[model samples]
Target: MSVLVYTESEQNKFKKAAFEVASYAKAVASQLGTTVTAVVINAEDTSELGNYGVDKVLKVSNSALDNFSAKTYASVLTEAAQSENAQVVILSSSADSKYLAPLLAIGLNAGYASNVVAAPLSTSPFKVKRSAFTNKAFEVTEIQSETKIIGVSNNSF
Candidate 1:
């Protein structure tokens, strides 16, 4: 019922991509008449997430998770998404997210798409626009899954 966005942080500060992903997720949630829930790990300032239209935030702070591990991060994100019963999961196409998205998708049994440029065209059938062929072309993808995952390329919005 909500859109879950994974907002990655570095050195206790969130990257610009985090806000972008939250903003994108918020748009999707608005279209679906739901809310945006952001998941952050080791982030010092989660207040800004609300500025990006995040309705809620789940913060996981653990010394054991100080280092970024694709497997661990994906596992945590998958759990958060499931707990929220998120209809959509949004991540920025950062280096870390690129490594984590597919694993999270597999764990959640959701359709995954990368380099997504915009929000869904329609929630039903879940259509989205993606940049294809190295941004030289575009395609509309229809994801026929109950849950959907999107990796938005940096600066795509």
Candidate 2:
């Protein structure tokens, strides 16, 4: 299975968190012995994602998605993940992503891990390091599910 990442954008331009999530996804993909596939909605210059180790890009150019709707975005990501047969989905810890993550997780029936500071400690058990208790402490969380959704903290990679 491939690792899927959501690359966030604004005004048709990719945000810094997009590349950061891509980098983190690439690391996870490497550890899992797979490739990274990124889903970009209404974004431009998708080729730049290749520099961040994205193997393939699924570009969604729809004006209907210009406005941020958590439901719609989650639907699109869910389809992308399923089509790619992705077991691992990566998202950046942005405001919009925070809203989208839970919806995506439920749609995929995946275990959600937020505020992840680093890549998985082990892929077999799907262990990851995440900030806990408002970042005052850190914890290693194990996702016990067939699918896993990770929300990487901003600039953590």
Candidate 3:
């Protein structure tokens, strides 16, 4: 199974968080012994993702997705993850990602971990370290589901 990452963009240009997530995905993919696949929505260029260790890029262009609708974005990501057979899905901790995370998790029937500060600690039991209580504390969470969704904190990687 591959590791899937959502690369967020604005005005057809990828945001900084996109690269951060891509890098984080690369680390996760290495731990999982798989490649990294990035999904870009309405982006103009995706070649730079390769520099961040993205193995494959899926570019999706649709006017209907120009506006940010949590439901619509979640649907698209869900489809990409399933098609890629992604066991782990990575997202940046942007506001839009936070909105989309739960929807995507429910759609994929995966466990959701937000504010992740680092790459997974273990892949067998699917454990990750995440920040809690406004980053004042940290917690180790184990996702029992076959599919896992991790929202990496901005600049954490």
Candidate 4:
């Protein structure tokens, strides 16, 4: 019942959008009565993730991870999520998430909400509310998978 948040930090602080993902994960974990953990590939101030209210952090450090590449990064995240047995995968709708989220979703066959803003009310049905077509509207969808991937809008809780 844990939620795994995928985030990256730049310039020794968390990226602007990653905070919202953390906030979202913190709240979702609170409501679900579970722990929230974050995965970082190459970040400057990874300890800042703790301030976001997550319980634990999984850092996948590698010199090769210095640059951004969707395919490679998503591959790392996929394994991390499986190792953690995360019920929900949380992401921010930044450029990175836009590129990597779907690959993670497709790789795991986990349901994805690319412009998500919230977590599910219950895990039994795995439903969530997400915006679509340029943040114009929202719809509650039932994710058809044992695992769920949520991509929250940038700078929005």
Clashes of each: 0, 0, 0, 0
**lDDT order of candidates, best first?**
2, 3, 1, 4
Worst 10 residues of 4 by lDDT: 115-124
- Which pairs of residues collide in model 2? none
- lDDT by residue (tens digit), candidate 2, 29-109: 999999999999998789999999999999999999999999999999999999999999999999999999999999999
Where does candidate 1 clash, by residue pair? none
Cα TM-score per model: 0.97, 0.98, 0.98, 0.90
Residue-level lDDT tens digits of model 1 in 27-127 = 99889999999999998879988899999999999987899999999899988998999979999999999999889989999999999998888888789
**In model 3, which residue pairs have backbone atoms overlapping below 3 Å?**
none
Tens-digit lDDT track of model 3 for 9-101 = 999999999999999999999998899999999998899999999999999999999999999999999999999999899999999999999
lDDT of 4 by residue, 1-157 (tens): 5799987676445777777888899988887789998997766557777888778888777887788889998999899889999878998888877899889998778878777666565656767777776778888888878888888877668
lDDT of 1: 0.91
Off by over 4 Å in 1: none
For model 1, give the RMSD to the true fold. 0.8
